[model samples]
Target: MIEIVARNGSPEAMLCPAFICDACRKQVMEAGNVIYAVRYPDQSERETSPLFVAHKGACDMAVQQWLAANYPVADGWSDLWDEIDDFLAYLGGNFKRSFAEDADGQYVPHVVVMPATSPKLP
Candidate 1:
């Protein structure tokens, strides 16, 4: 299973931590940009999961391609990819709407973890 999350700090903070994109190696400075926290099947928990943060465009595409090349397709890889795409679309829409409603409002960091499947027996 793969999990994706979008994160940003609260608007009330004096300073927000920088989230650097794993793909592009650049800072993720916008709330509207898509961020992902991928947890593979082998990962037992979200904390231990290898996070793959990237922007919604070219960087994200590169991450997907890399995932496809490294992981097996039969393990629901496509489903995870689709989920990420959907999440990105949702975030984009929400950001636009939020911006229109309150351009000055600061976005808080939030995490959305995907449902985990049954653990593999040793």
Candidate 2:
């Protein structure tokens, strides 16, 4: 679903599950390559969200032209540099799966063998 987010009293486009720029019809992989465009919602009663992602260098002209033809107000559209790999650090931990060599020389799940003297065993 497309959601329009407002930042600093200005509308920002938030494209979810879609990296394609709506303005230039190109993929927006890096966050630093985004130019947000805000306009009035097409629906009157229903709330709408930002639905476009334009490239910074390639879509600059296209975004500007679209904004000029659609929204003449200064606050209608804005550009922002975003971090593309911001979420890459979400899983920060030193965890590794225990594996054992199988007959085929392939890694397999390691079984924890406890001694009979251990209290964990019956």
Candidate 3:
């Protein structure tokens, strides 16, 4: 997945522009409704991967649940697997990651603001 983070800290919500939601297929009208941007890498020969725009609460919950269910504990850390919730929370609260699709249909990086001329549709 493509995850971009701010160099200094989390991105200011108000400064982010609205985009079409990759999860719900709706317009993400405000910053308050954004969950996070998740870029799924191509598993085959495709040049670009799909970027998904998650809704705030619902998408966060879904990601957490998926992490909990699918992520296995590492070799030496028994407690690490149980900390997925905290990890996800930290990413959401401490970073500036967003979704951006490229010409190859991959969600690339935009560490701060969305690119001025980036395509809006996913």
Rank by TM-score, descending? 1, 2, 3
Runs of candidate 2 with Cα error greater than 4 angstroms are 1-16, 31-51, 74-122
For candidate 3, lDDT tens digit of each residue in 14-79? 333344444445554333222222222333322211233444666545543433233223411111
Clashes of each: 1, 3, 1
| Clashing residue pairs found in predicted model 1 | 8-109
| Pairs in clash, predicted candidate 3 | 49-106
Q: What TM-scores do the predictions have?
A: 0.37, 0.34, 0.25
Superposed by TM-score, candidate 2 places the C-alpha of residue 45 at a distance from the truth, in angstroms, of: 15
lDDT by residue (1-122, candidate 2, tens digit) is 12343334336555345455545454566552333333333333222123334555546556545534443456343333333343223212212322352354554222222212211111
* Model 1: residues with Cα > 4 Å off, grouped in runs: 1-16, 31-49, 76-122
Rank list by lDDT: 1, 2, 3
| Reference-based lDDT, residue 56, model 1 | 64
For TM-score, candidate 1 versus 2, the one ahead is 1
Model 2: worst 10 consecutive residues (lDDT sum): 113-122
Model 3, global lDDT: 0.36
**For model 1, what is the C-alpha lDDT against the true structure?**
0.47
Model 2, residue pairs in steric clash: 4-49, 4-50, 21-53
lDDT of each: 0.47, 0.39, 0.36
- What does the lDDT read for residue 99 in candidate 2? 31
Per residue, candidate 1 scores C-alpha lDDT tens digits across 1-122 of: 22333455676435435545556666755531333334344444221223455666777676655544444356534314333455567767887786436768754433344325322211
